[model samples]
Target: MSSAGRVPQGLRRVYLNVRPERLGVLIGEGGKTLRDLENRTQTIVSVDSLNSSVVIEAATPETPIEMVLRASDFIKAIDAGFSPERALRLLDEDMVLIIINLKEVIGDSQSHLYRVKARVIGEEGKVRTNIEQLTGTYISVYDDLVAIIGDYEGAYLAREAIEMLIQGREHSTVYRFLNKKVRELKRKRLTEYWKKDFSTKEVKS
Candidate 1:
């Protein structure tokens, strides 16, 4: 048994719609991602498996502002839908996907496909990380699809860099510009990822 003050208190809730398939990724291994989000925003994030919705509970008055902001970020990503093209656009980069219908790249086994994906992701995810940091965008490469998420300027820069890479531009060149871009947007606000306040509680029917 716990004392009254020791018991946890409930906060305001904000709901989000998420695809069933991507739910696991959002939750992560052992709920790692969910826990990270909760710690960072100081909120309680509960997911309803049946409804495919997320409930965010603010820990305090201050928590509501941050919780809503973070919740909005997740909602936007979910609502925008998954498109390698759109993700790159969100990252402010122009990108092209070399669609290979088969699971493996020509002359290589499935393992080869993994290598190619790794090549795009780069060392310790440095390549993708640099792109996101510089352009203030998000880049995710899954299987044969490479998703880019950022604003216009970042997208433009990313597009040029990606095109150059596809055209056989040296990795060094692409990485250099990527670094520069990261510095540029370091303090920039990504409005596209921003969500308006949803702190108000839902009215009961």
Candidate 2:
């Protein structure tokens, strides 16, 4: 398809401007990640190196809206700072993407972005790793954006934790909050499991 054919017949396209430095990460080795994404989502993906823009289009009229949306989401996730591997999780029905724009919080004080991002990243990326492990999420602190990929429960808790950090809440306080949330999530998962098990047993009987 010609680059000028921006709008494929019976299909829609989503254009995203990716960071120049991160473009290689999005493209991956020899375009393997890009091809994998296209195959998984059944969408045509075109990356313009010079412009650092990506175009995602539905492969056919029969293609589901969800497929297109997921593909778009995956690209946006990469733009938002997530690795392509983590971004691919957007394809999962239960996984979600969340991006916190530092500009929203920093307003005109763009300089504050570096400090806030640093706090989330911690001394050696330990804080970020802790939050991911505690909340079962993947986090990426890139440029002026903080990106997260996880299931609904994990994403919600991780997002909250991240916001607290961005707000300059004490690190210890955030750690406690995450610990408490982790237990709550574990309990909820156990309850759901028991309910599902009971239903299965009843059906068997």
- Best prediction by TM-score: 2
What lDDT does each candidate get? Answer: 0.56, 0.86
lDDT of 1 at 106: 36
TM-score of each: 0.40, 0.89
lDDT of 2 by residue, 60-161 (tens): 665566787889889888888777878888999899988888888777576687789889999999999999999899998887888889999899899999
Model 1: lDDT equals 0.56
Per-residue alpha-carbon lDDT of candidate 1 for residues 16-123, written as tens digits (9 for 90 to 100): 776677677667789876676667666778888788888777765555453445444554453334432232222212322222222432334767656655656688
Q: In terms of TM-score, how similar is model 1 to the real structure?
A: 0.40
User: Which stretches of candidate 1 lie above 4 Å from their native place?
Assistant: 1-12, 75-136, 140-205
Deviation in Å, model 2, residue 58 alpha carbon: 0.7
